[model samples]
Target: MSLENNKIFASVLTAGILLMASGFAAKSLYHPKDLEENAFKIEVSDSGVEVASAGAEEPSIEPISALLATADVAAGESGFKKCASCHTIESGGSNKVGPALWDIVGRGRAAVDGFSYSDALQGMSSEAWDYEALNEFLAKPKDYAPGTKMGFAGLKKVEDRANLIAYMRMQSDSPAALPQ
Candidate 1:
């Protein structure tokens, strides 16, 4: 009985050794290289429909100008709820996780006092938070300012952005005129 157990252990050890050796041989025979870029790309819309291929040009974003004229401020107030966690919209509101957003429209980029902005935003100090800039930034924070610390994924719907901006416009002492 002891002899039979030894033979069984030896057979298992040999099998394991042969399997490892074959694995090493296979890996050495094939030198796999990572691709420089994705071989193919798939883009899906909000509705889950496949939208584009690898080579397709990015779909142009609809400008918010037309939508802002009649944007619902009430709806915008509701939308601002998403931003309230990080920002405060009232005048003289203290900064929270993000700087207070009172009168943010037309304010110079990275202009908030006492808040340390990322290098990416600081570098853009020359720019102001104009409607178009806000539109772009609010669409995709990372895309607009690559190294920004704002973790919000951004509002995808143009109407939602228009409403939010319109709401923000109302927060200022003198809201800038809507785009023509």
Candidate 2:
């Protein structure tokens, strides 16, 4: 109705258009591509379904036994920095948040003194801490021993697990031989 009113309307319309255009540009800039290309597939279905991507196969996990043959003990010791907060590796090392890991290789499960082990781990007392067992346990502690108190998410890399186990072997009075 008035020139001033027209100018105000135009300003508001321009601002709205600019804001909409910027939103569209941002959406185009940050839109995620198909996760299958990144080795991830989303599966949805009724009854809690799982779906496999059409194009990608899951990567095979190399057995820790194989990797231990060439595992770098030094690199493993370096990697142990991640575990230092929860464990002490020295001989007769008192239990920390978790049990002392000294001589852990080939040791019986839940055998450490004074440290209270979760029932999940204690259930594994029939087994020794062999290479295959260590690999599985270290790869995913929760998966390996459900209901256990170990809070780590586990190592995702085979090489890292192998190296870490190798380093742990060296901490023992009688280091276990690497798996063939």
Candidate 3:
């Protein structure tokens, strides 16, 4: 490697070591004074991400739609309520703040008409909203499609994401789950 590359690599290594050391010191210093309150932790799931308490004993809260087809449709539509502000639900509806939601499930990114999309989103080449891509997008829209206009923080609840996906699928003409 070049000398410049070595310098960059060393700087990154030093920063990582410093950060990890600081985190360990902070944990040791605060773990005792910190209250034993449980907080949510994030984890990756087969479909998307799931959250659970750091140390609390609780039953599994896997989204109902993740396993139950009937529940998925309900959750999906209900979840879309949060997204209605920027998107219109009607098929072929005029663009809202964002592109129209018509037939988006199996459609390619940046494929909408009339509406001006961010180069960030319009630049994406993802062919369509497949399950895996959709899950990641919903998990964190801004991150998955960086520079996209979506400002959603993400659905913290697995069920909410699953349900929302179910709802979107139904909205698409692609013969998704029949209306619940």
Candidate 4:
């Protein structure tokens, strides 16, 4: 090889060797064979607890029927601010990142005009919006409808979900009657 080519090749070879040596040295130094376990344990009890067995499904949260009685529409409207970025709750509103949510509480899933829904959500078109379903869905949209395109992480609070549903119920001219 020419003198310049030889020098370049030597430099490349040295770099590769140094990189490999550094990785090997870091691996040995960070995790020695004689390292002690540093994890802490917290004791738990099963008394009066409904613990699911391994490989068994855990129980879903209680129905939203109970929460509806105490639902605060004002609180729900405030909570909906997070959703406003993607959806417009105003009647006759145009679709944004998500479908306008006017009358959504009683509307069929994926029934919005002009807005395209993910296949995961479209598959649930047979179901109408109801308190329990809305509750479960708002708790975790992705978990409720796997593969859904909604980017929301979901509201973790039951009161928030109830309030949001209440606010949604108010958006409709003839809102579906609330569940007892």
The per-prediction CA RMSD against the true structure, in angstroms, equals 7.0, 8.9, 16.5, 8.1
C-alpha lDDT of candidate 3 relative to the true structure: 0.72
lDDT of 2 by residue, 1-180 (tens): 999999999999999999999999999899776664647556677857676677989665468887777889999999999999999999989899999999999999999989999999889888899888888889889978989999999999889998999999999988887766
In order, candidate lDDTs are: 0.92, 0.89, 0.72, 0.88
Query: Could you say which candidate leads in lDDT?
Result: 1
Q: What would the TM-scores of all predictions be?
A: 0.75, 0.67, 0.57, 0.71
Better of 1 and 2 by lDDT: 1
| Candidate 4 ranges with C-alpha deviation above 4 Å | 1-59
Cα-based lDDT at residue 101, candidate 4: 94
| Model 4 Cα shift for residue 160 (angstroms) | 0.8
lDDT of 4 at 10: 97
Poorest 10 consecutive residues of model 3 by lDDT?
59-68
Better of 1 and 2 by TM-score: 1
Candidate whose TM-score is highest: 1
Q: How many residue pairs in model 3 have overlapping backbones?
A: 3
Looking at candidate 4, the ten consecutive residues that score lowest on lDDT are 41-50
For residues 8-126, could you state the per-residue lDDT of candidate 4 as single tens digits? 99999999999999999999889656538646644446665555556988668667888887899999999989999999999899999999999998789999978889999999999
- Between prediction 2 and prediction 4, the one with superior lDDT is 2
- Across 34-85, the per-residue lDDT of candidate 1 in tens digits comes to 9998899667899798977669898666788888899999999999999999
